[model samples]
Target: MTQPDRDPGLQPERTRLAWRRTTLSATVAAILAAKTALHGGASAAGLVACAACCVLWLGFLLVAHRRIRDLAVPGRPTALAPRWATGAVLCTVAIALCAAALVV
Candidate 1:
């Protein structure tokens, strides 16, 4: 009886790249939201929504950056914690909602 060797392959690299892409998307969304808020009449509520978008972007960035860093380390990376995952999801959804608020 013999155990098969595990093939790490490029999965980790792919995951890291995916996270980078997501981070980029979040950055773009935040930037667009700010631009809209500034040029689209700058209402008090719009400004507040823009600020919230920035905060949510930063939060998501922190979560993504930590995951990317973990993926870069050799050996098996630890599973993402439930809290971090939840935070990332919430931040993303909230960012979209805030952006939509600015638009409407």
Candidate 2:
């Protein structure tokens, strides 16, 4: 028997799911870091950093959601190019998480 062909949008759907997972991970990590910071020596600074990380994650979530919505279109896009803000904030969040861990 012949194998069934995959849907054209299957890749995009998987990509969208991956983005959602990334956003979720960022949110959880931010919350944990915030909690760690709150109990650290500098409560004020830790809380402030936590708030900033949450805000940045929120921004990336919104941008990723919007970009994924356009993934279903039949345009002839060659490669995946994430928006600058999304990529920058995602990297920033990773670095901030490390810094928060050290400080906490």
Report RMSD (Å) for each prediction in the order shown.
Answer: 4.1, 4.7
The clash number for model 2 is 0
lDDT of model number 1: 0.84
Question: On residues 1-104, what C-alpha lDDT tens digit does candidate 2 reach at each position?
Answer: 63345456577677768878877887787677667766647666766776676676677677777667766555432345656555746656564765556475
Using all chains and alpha carbons, the TM-scores for the candidates as numbered come to: 0.82, 0.65
Q: Rate the local accuracy (lDDT) of all candidates.
A: 0.84, 0.65
**Model 1 lDDT per residue over 1-22, tens place:** 5333333476778888999998
- In angstroms, the error of model 2 at 25 is 1.3
C-alpha RMSD (angstroms) for model 1: 4.1
Candidate 2 worst ten-residue window by lDDT: 73-82
TM-score of 1: 0.82
